[model samples]
Target chain A: MKKKAIIYGVSLGPGDPDLITLKGLKILQEADKIYYPGSLFKSGLKSSYSLSILEHYKLDTTKFEGFYLEMDLTRVKVNELYDLTFEKIIEDYNKDLKIAIVSEGDVNTFSSFSYLLEKIKKENFNVKLIPGITSFALAAAENLAPLCLQNEKLIILPRVQTETELEEALTHFNTVVLMKIKTVMNVINNVLSKGNYSIYYSEKLGTTHQFITSNLEEINKRDIPYFSLITIKK
Target chain B: MKKKAIIYGVSLGPGDPDLITLKGLKILQEADKIYYPGSLFKSGLKSSYSLSILEHYKLDTTKFEGFYLEMDLTRVKVNELYDLTFEKIIEDYNKDLKIAIVSEGDVNTFSSFSYLLEKIKKENFNVKLIPGITSFALAAAENLAPLCLQNEKLIILPRVQTETELEEALTHFNTVVLMKIKTVMNVINNVLSKGNYSIYYSEKLGTTHQFITSNLEEINKRDIPYFSLITIKK
Candidate 1:
């Protein structure tokens, strides 16, 4: 009987296949099966960033089985997704199948991998996290500025949340990274205006459609996307 | 005559040759001349990480024209280094030659590149920043933990000054990354203890001698090196 079943929570660095780490690529090549979160799109494909890296490795998703989870962040839904994924792992455990679960960014940061991690730990399955290039790092890279200076404090908050959370993060941090800017641009812009923080907005960093602007007023006038990031440096 | 001369701020990621990004590699390959920060121990030799990647491409340090900066960050030494490097770039600019300035990590993060940047901006030279992987990302990857959470705030501070700054950072941030830990471990440890934060320590992340420990008590017993990092998760 196989005594150990290894699960790798791999981060596919910000949307670029070339940006994926050598270690991440190595795991993708070696894993007996690769699991990625599927979307609710009509075609039933995985997320765009992870799919690119997986395709770069010549790994055919059709060949290996995939587990789909609803794109919801509520605790109950997240827990359900993990439970289902864990059950699949348990069934494959006796066969000594090594599984790789790929996340868009670093596994421990705003990733579904955390939920799975909790479930796996409860089931006594051994799991390891493989970190990758985060969108924040990529956005900073595109801007040619440091995200957080030597003594600078940085706050990373989701933009789709309540305005109170945004205001608190803005006031407290030396550098604030507001993710998912499309959903709450007006509120974020109003907060930025009130705080007197200059904004650097980036969309699709590293891709052909990548747009970066330091003008907050100009950004407010444009249509922002879900993947856009806004940085306010103090 | 070309009105603009390109200056590349290249990141040689985390002491590994292959870890450099495709864009970073392209800049190195295409640059008219490559300049690296020089060390007293080995003048004109490429940094170990840069050398590794260059070797794969059949490029030798001896083949490229080299410039050395012997500026120390302590006291007023950094200014002298900046002046000398800036003068070299100015000379090249006068000659209509484009230059590439490479550093070990991302150009803007806790790097000497900023000093040079200040000088260049003062002189009004056309400059472009090329991003590379930072040690923080590598450290996180080596430890297999995410550096920042979904809504969590992060603070990155170098131990260049007093502990009061660190304490202030801790009070406002959820995650704190303390760089240059060798010189200020005692003060940083005190702050971590006072804050009641769990600490993760990584020494020489990504290299053969890499060591990571979450046991703060054990960390205190070990001699922390220059490459060591202390992360406080609140």
Candidate 2:
């Protein structure tokens, strides 16, 4: 009888390598193989946030085989990616490999790793999800504002698809954190204009290129980046 | 001219010493003074979660001067505690100290350190808030559930005061994380029963005394503790 391989869902924590938890860092450094689910943007490998964080920390990646789980959903079918990932993970499991899927922020928090983990977990492989510092928390610190005080409600809208939902969330919650608002910024800005919410915007938090602005007017005038986050307090 | 004291807000990260970020750990190790905002429990000094995490990590406490910012609001007036904390901080500033306030989880996310930082920042002191892994994130990972799917809304209700608020939040958001639900567990449980939501319960996450349950029935029957949290997916 052979032992099944263990899969670790490691969170890199925002953009700073230093922000990665000791547990996460340990697993990343000790993993037999590292797998990063690259974004569907320009170049999948180039936009791999986790790999950049690992490189920044100067972890010896050459010691292990690094794999990029590139799934361009827009260009390829979802089933194709799922089947490919399923087979890849199963193959590793047969080899008794200790694989880690590096994710941004907490692995269980609106992460792409969630989809892959679902497929991996079905095979009854040993899996562990290591939590990390969330980007909203960093954005809150960058702006020197509490995400929510005592008894205050905080709504985290990863992507506000509808204007109606945005209006409702803004009205109901004490604080609203809008993530990945790049594509829908125009619509979000319009809905935000109708409300009397104080906004704090941050892009590429914890990185050298990090930007912060408390002025909603400034955020409205700028070209919002893909990684940008907006915090609105009522 | 006297140099202002530098204050660092260090987050301990979800009650696990290993979960502390490298940046937070480094600051904790090098801090000249460590100040922990004690809880109003049995003993102010004994109930410091950050201190326990430090001890768990086997960090030496002999090198630095440790201070307990004992602000028991239940027993003492807020103004009195605020004044005493202010005076103590100012006195340290006079000595040109580098004090670190050890906070649990992200300092900017519903932490008691926020109040102290507000006072310290007003005095033009240099303060830095380092982020950490939040308990809810850990709980989600423990239950192997995603906090928020691609476009799903997530609401973090730190302290749910009113039943109406809980109803609205659960009804609107795809996921609702209710923290510090000790007092309102019965009410929340009653409301939770009405929805077809899957619940994940965790108490003292990442600590040795940690508890996790997917069964809402068991959670409802048990005595909810102060450190307990409930995550509901709609």
Candidate 3:
């Protein structure tokens, strides 16, 4: 039986190329065209950490297209990029070509796939999202950390805007997972010193330069990357 | 260099055998023994949904061991099962055999690994947790729904006991993910009728008996499974 022509969005998982699920791997292979996100530099060439993971698999490069997502988060710019990306996807969809949209982490998580999905809904496009492993899961796994246990509340916040927010989570939840802490490290540092807690930190996980640590001082000594995450457990 | 022998805990994703990460698959194949969890019926036979997913891959059954975990959550019984399981793992560890402890979803997320991990800490065991695709991720992916987005708080609660708590999350966070909703269908059903919010419900995801829907009424029509989950999005 022939599978119907449609668009599929797959998560590559975090870092290690081998983390990609068999279902995601199969969709990537079967798709006629694969679209992935990348940051376009001033030189007009794009570089994508997500694409670099694919290098391990060494999939056919001819079928892949990189959507140059700029670093600026201006609403107009962001909307334009996704809108244009959808335009190209619709073209392929109209031709009955199978399309795969690739994202770095779980497509359901805070990833580019969400923006694309919103556009997909408006057009009534046939799309399937293949779930992938989340970075936080891998980060906790590598460190032998429990994300949350029986009756434990897990709050995954993108930012710890204030010390109060961090403190509230620390007090109320059994475990707090804070992501993209590069800019809000101060709030975390203050709360850490004020309480008795265990810290597990990972940056650029699954890559060659990956860093993992339990010592807060060790992490404080270095510049935290945007991909860095910490599980503050009590 | 050959990968060194260690006790590895790998998540089998939710239901689909193919949803297991490539790394998890490789570890399971190479392990000297693979241990999974299930219930031992009065008939002296065991049934495990996690192991059933493995049947799709059709790995060697001889290498598998099913630990009988009672339906009861008594701490004494729970401790006994994991303690004995760890004892055997240690026996294999002493023999320098590579071992894999299998769980259904992400090992880091509210699974038996946390209980086993507590036991491992008593003795220095060379162990690694290989994260797997989470069922919630699969649930969201299937519905083209976003678990969370920029600056949105994502609260994952095993129980939403009160209407106030559910309302709080839906009001503050962009998305609230509730797992194991089988027991709390009444509370959910109450909120569904009161609000104009969107609901994405999933049960036995990626399995033959999988149920998924955005319609709250359709869910009320059937008996909710224990594995069911819901995401209330405002």
Candidate 4:
């Protein structure tokens, strides 16, 4: 009988190649194949932050195969994407190969791994996750700031969330991290100004083009990228 | 001109030795001295999970010195601890030695690093932080679950927070992570039962004695350690 393949959902950490956990690297190195998110592939593997990490460590990627998984959440039906990915994963598993689905930041947080994991649990293949540093945590480190104090709360909301949701979160939590802040720059600026909160913004954390600012005015004036994150403390 | 020393606040990730980022490990290996939280020293470094990680990775600790910094937030005056630690750090910096203040999980999350940073900001020494995988995130990974949906909010609150604060948080956020769960387990259990939330609990994550369970009843029947964490989905 052939051994069933396994899936390791790996979190690559916040954009820095060096930040990938040793266990994450070990799992990637030993895996039969590594699958990267479609977003990273579009940027090219040579320049991709995660792939750069493997190169920096002088790991032998030649022996392991790499694959790209496309994710168009807005346009594609979510279930279809899950089904296709699950099929692809099981096919590789049937061949007795260990597969890794690599995502930026921790695998369980707003990650593509979730979609696949949700669909694949009924299958016979073994699945596990390796966590990594989160982007908001990295942003806090970059600013030399704490996400929260004792008895305080932190709220993390995606950019696609309603402006009302953002405002409510800011009012309730000690620190609020708004992820993917490209389109809501003005809305966030307004909230920060009205709430009298300390604002820190960062885009593509740990990358060469990474941008960060504590100046609320500068953030309002600048063109925030789709990958930008804003942390507010009231 | 005499060079100034610096301190690196290293996030050691959850309990797993292999989970420490490569950058974190590199800094730890190269630091002239390493400072561990007083709580861990009381527990003994030989048995401490973080030290075990270094040993597991075969990093030579003999060449580098280790210092213990006392921190009893509940019993002692917090400022006095901060003042003493700041003085010790500056003395090391004056000798032009790189020092690392190691903390479990992310340094910016309810970490002692915050107090030190607040006290030592005006000093001549440089300070930087290295982010790590959080126990709550690791617990999510261990359960093969996601912390939140695309736009769902996540709340992280320490145990000292009042029961009212937790209830307020549960009403506001889609998911809530309660840290230091030993004292508040009953309150949390009551909340879970009332709110109809899905609960996942883990203690000493990544350690040999680590225990995790999705069954709320199992958790209620047992003695929850001070290091325990619970992630709830409402």
Best by lDDT: 3
The candidates, ranked best first by lDDT, are: 3, 2, 4, 1
Per-residue CA lDDT of model 4 for A180-217, tens digit only, reads: 77876667766666767788888878889899999987
Fnat, one value per model: 0.44, 0.83, 0.91, 0.88
Give the 10-residue window scoring lowest on summed lDDT in candidate 4 chain B. Answer: B63-72
Model 4: share of real contacts kept = 0.88
Clashes of 1: 0
How much is A40 displaced in model 4, in angstroms? 9.7
Q: Give the TM-score of candidate 1.
A: 0.81
Looking at candidate 3, what is the lDDT of residue A130? Answer: 92
lDDT tens digits, residues B1-234, model 1? 866577877776666665666566777777777777644333434343444445565544553544444434464664665677678788887777667777776676666666677677777777777666677766765555566655566666666366787777677667778888787777876776765677789887656777889888888888888778877777
Residue lDDT tens for model 2, B100-219: 878887787777777887887788788888988888899988888889878788889876877888898877788989998888876787787777888899988898889999898788
lDDT by residue for model 3 (B151-177), tens: 778888887898888887777678888
lDDT of 1 by residue, A1-234 (tens): 675568877777777776665566677788888877655444554554566556877875653555565464566875676677778877776578778888876676667666677666676676776666677777776676676655555666664466676777666566778787786877876677776666789888767888899988788777777678888886
CA RMSD of all predictions: 4.2, 2.7, 2.2, 3.3
lDDT of 2 by residue, A1-234 (tens): 457479999998998889998898888778777777554443643356676777876666763433444454553565566577668777877888878888888798778788888887787778999998888999988788888766777889987888898888777778989998988887787888887778899998989999999887888787777789999888
Clashing pairs in 2: none
In lDDT terms, how accurate is model 1? 0.69
Task: Please give me the total number of clashing residue pairs in predicted model 2.
Answer: 0
Q: What TM value does the first chain of each candidate achieve?
A: 0.86, 0.88, 0.95, 0.85
Order the candidates by TM-score, highest first: 3, 2, 4, 1
lDDT, candidate 4, B1-234, per-residue tens: 456467899988878888899999898888887766543234554334445455665655663333344444443655665677678777778888888888878899877667777765767458888998888889999887799767777888877346677788888778888887787776776667776778888888888888888898898887878778888887
Task: After the best TM-score superposition of candidate 2, give how far the Cα of residue A16 lies from its true spot, in angstroms.
Answer: 0.6
